[model samples]
Target: MEIDPSEVQSLYRTLAGAVVPRPIAWVSTRSEDGVDNLAPYSFFNVVSVAPPVVMFAPVDGQDGLKDTPANIRETDEFVVNVVTEPLAEAMNQTSATLPHGESEFDHAGLDRAESTTVDAPRVAKTPVAFECSLYEMIDIGASTMVLGEVEWVHVDDSVTTDDKLDVEKIDAVGRLSGSLYATTDDRFSLERPP
Candidate 1:
């Protein structure tokens, strides 16, 4: 079946559903007035690693940019936290829409720790967090892609190995379309052939 981009709203569901197990970026950013906002976006991935850049797309509200993207545009900083099984519920809670200036961390009963390189706080219990400074924002129809350059990284000692992250220990969670979710636990190693 052929679909038209003009009716993005209609085809988005199918597209999102087929993009199985997309990584969750539990993003945290602060508003200009210091209101802390946290939300999860499944449309997130590492776009470049050489200079360490990650991107997440958040669809705009009826008026304009969503709180997270607006805040990032204001503060020029944000933190991307890797969501784990244990924090899944709390991470999901932050996605609820609240009035301007409301704190999702408080709303979700989550703790926050200061970021090393950015003013935005990181999720305290997150196994991995990347403190990023905004590099660019690209608007696509009703959505915007936020590109950030990693300025600093924080990893819980419990989830790290010899200069690498142990995914088994992290047990990161991913979005599987609609209300469904997935875990990294059922993973297999694939060796590259020369």
Candidate 2:
């Protein structure tokens, strides 16, 4: 089926549907007033590893500068929390469009922990969180891709295997199209060719 960019509804659905099991970045930021903001973005991934950079794209509504992007613009920092199956419902609660300066952490009954580096607070329950500083932003059509340098990483030892975090232990959740979600439980590994 040919996709028409003009039909934004179909475009959003089709594009998101085609990209199955996209990893979600549970981004937490702080407003200039010091209010906390938390939201989930499925359009996120590690774009670079040399300097450790990650990105999340927020699509603009008819009104621009949603809470997350607006807060990042003012503070230049955010924490990307890894969402696990246990935290899925709470994470989904945070995706609500609240009033400016409203705290999603409070709304979702999630505890906030102070970050060692950035001023932004991290999800206290998340097994993994990345403290990030705004590296760059790229404009693409109506969405803006926000890149951040991973200044610090917080990982639970319970999820660590040797030097890496075990996927089964972390049990991270992924976003599919519409209200569908997935977990890391269904996974297999194949050795890479050297």
Candidate 3:
């Protein structure tokens, strides 16, 4: 079936559905008023490696800028927490729309760990968390792409092999369309062409 961007009734759904198995960035940020905000964004991935940069796109809500992007704008700091199978339920709980001054960490019943490089708190239960400072924010259509430079990384030893992250151990969850989600359990590797 052929589809046109202008003709598609629900472009967001169509695009999100086609993307298949997008990684979730369980972003946590602290508001200027000291409120801790946490939310999950499926439109997320690594932007660079050498300097260690990551990005996540948060689209404007009906009420305008979401708490995550707005907080990052004010503080220029955030933490990207990895969502594993065990933390999936709690991560989903954080997606609820809360009042501006409310804390999602409390809503999700999750603990916060103080970050070393940034004031933003990290998810204490997450096996991996990246403490980042805002690198840039670009307005892309209806979404704001937040680029962050990794200032510090917290990875539990259980998810590591030879001091490097082990995917099997991490057991990270991925976002599919709608309420569907996936796990990294079913994976395969192929040698790249030289």
TM-score for each candidate, following the candidate numbering: 0.95, 0.95, 0.97
- Model 2's TM-score against the true structure: 0.95
114 Cα displacement, candidate 3 (Å): 0.9
| Candidates 1 and 3 compared by TM-score, better number | 3
Q: Rate the local accuracy (lDDT) of all candidates.
A: 0.93, 0.93, 0.94
Screening candidate 1 with a backbone cut-off below 3 angstroms (N, C-alpha, C), the clashing residue pairs are: none
Model 3 lDDT per residue over 1-194, tens place: 88788876658887899898999999999989999999999999999998899999999888778999999999999999999999999999999987778899999899999999999999998999999999999999889999999999999999999999988888999999999999999989999999
Model with the higher TM-score, candidate 2 or 3: 3
Candidate of highest lDDT? 3
State in Å the error of residue 181, model 1.
Answer: 0.1
| Colliding residue pairs in candidate 3 | none
RMSD of each: 1.4, 1.5, 1.0
Worst 10-residue lDDT window, candidate 1: 3-12
- For candidate 1, the per-residue lDDT at 57 reads 98
Going through the candidates in the order shown, the clash numbers are 0, 0, 0
